[model samples]
Target: MKALVFGADGFEDLELFYPYHRLKEEGITTHVASMKKGPITGKHGYEITADIAFKDVNSADYDIIVISGGKGPEKMRLDKDALEIVKNFFKKNKPVASICHGPQVLVSADVIKGRKATCWIGIRDDIIAAGAQYEDSEVVVDGNLVSSRNPGDLHAFGREMIKLLK
Candidate 1:
């Protein structure tokens, strides 16, 4: 399966690397589509170079879209193009998984208005306002959408994603 992982400049390092490595173990092809092509620093001061530019990735080519979050969401949620990409993928019925503050993008996309999802506690209100039913569980899967509370929830998130990809 082909997966598109989206991260802007300050995403959680673990959120990005863990899923990327886990997906590879399942023989899934995952691409890092970010706002820029060069190295982007993570919330913890780690830097990762993106593999593909967001504008260069087409939704039709990917099986699922994963959006990771952290300190970046506070700024990323305001990006029009990124929001559009989330809406487009959701509208197409492609699977989507968001972690930490990543749900903010879905909220901005206006796609979570009635979906059940999980995200970091601080952002639950934002998710609810965006039209989703927020859950406090470690992981929540509503149809094609999956989410987790934080980095510690990565195991469940990765397991769920592998099932979805399979």
Candidate 2:
């Protein structure tokens, strides 16, 4: 199976790294995509090279999409191409895993209106404003979408994502 992970500068270090590596450990081929080519830095000072650019992604070519949280999503959600990628994945009903601020992209994509989801407490208002039912749990799996609250919830987030993939 193939997975595409999306993020940009200031992404939560654990939120992106944990899922990317965990999915790879599960034998799933995973690629990272960002707004531009080259290295994307995390809020914690770690940097990762993006494998593809948002403009070049084709959601149908992959089995799942992962969105990482952080200040990154604040800028990422404003990108039309980024928002479209999230929408296409949801449109196809493929499994989507997002953590923390990552759900901001889903909000921009306008795909989580009625879905149950969780995200950083700071964005709970935005999630509800987008019409999604916000939960305070560590993780929430609503249909093909899996969401988590923050870095502290990465374990449950990754576990739920792998479970969904299976």
Candidate 3:
């Protein structure tokens, strides 16, 4: 299995790293992609090198897509290529896991409308505005999409994703 994780500068470190490592532990080959190739810093000062650039990602190559939240989503939502990638994952009905501000990209992709989801409290209004049923739970899994409020919910988020993959 192959997984694609998308993030940029200021991404929540745990949100990205936990799932990345968890997926690998499950024997899933994972690739980190950002707008640029090379290292991207997290909000907490940790850095991760992106394996590929956003322009090079083809959703068809991935079995699952992970969107990690933080300040990064504020910028990634404005990226057409990133939105396209998100849309393709949904279009293909592949598993998608998004945490915190990550839903902003799904909102931009227009795939969560009428779907149940969870995200950071700060973006609760945005999630509603995008037409999704907002849940305040630690995690919400609707069909192929799994969403969590923040790093605190990573355990449930990762568990649900792995369950779906199996």
Candidate 4:
């Protein structure tokens, strides 16, 4: 299996790197893609040099796409390219995993309509407003989607993601 991790900038480091290493350990090739080509800073001021730019990723090349959450979501939501990359996965029926404030982008992409998911409590209204159903669970699995509340739920998040990938 192959995975796409989308983090524009200011993403939570644990949110992106945890599953990234998990995929690698399981022999699932991973690609880190974002809007720009160089280093994208994390919320804690850590720099994650992306392995691929959004312009280079094709939905057909990955089996799953994981989007991390952070303050970046507020700005990244307005990025058409990031939104399109996410929508393509759902349109193709590939699994898409998002957490925390990450729902902002998925909802902005218009791919969450009628699907059940979870996100940061603050964004519950945003998810609902996007035409998707919300479950107040730490993790909710709806079809090809998986979501969790925050970094504290990363354990469940990674487990659920691995289950779906398998």
Give the TM-score (vs. native) of candidate 2. Answer: 0.98
For candidate 4, lDDT tens digit of each residue in 13-46? 8898888888898999998887777888898887
Q: How far is candidate 4 from the true structure (C-alpha RMSD, Å)?
A: 1.2
| RMSD, one per candidate, in order | 1.3, 0.8, 0.7, 1.2
The TM-scores, one per candidate, come to 0.93, 0.98, 0.98, 0.94
| Regions more than 4 Å wrong, model 3 | none
Residue 37 CA displacement from its true place in model 3, Å: 0.9
Q: Compared with the true structure, what per-residue lDDT tens digits does model 3 show for residues 1-166?
A: 8999988999999999999999999999999988888999999999999999878887788999899999988888888888888888888888999999999999999999999999999999998999999999999999999999999999999999898899
Q: Order the candidate numbers by TM-score, best to worst.
A: 3, 2, 4, 1
* Minimal lDDT window, size 10, model 1: 72-81
Local distance difference test values of all predictions, in order: 0.83, 0.92, 0.92, 0.86
C-alpha lDDT of candidate 1 relative to the true structure: 0.83
The residue ranges of model 1 lying beyond 4 angstroms of the native Cα positions read none
lDDT of 1 at 3: 81
Q: Where does model 4 exceed 4 Å of error? A: none
- Candidate 2: list runs displaced more than 4 Å: none
Q: How many clashes (backbone N, Cα, C below 3 Å) per candidate?
A: 3, 0, 0, 0
lDDT of candidate 1 at residue 42, scale 0 to 100: 88
TM-score of 4: 0.94
Residue 54 lDDT in candidate 1: 65
In model 1, what is the error at residue 117, expressed in angstroms? 0.5
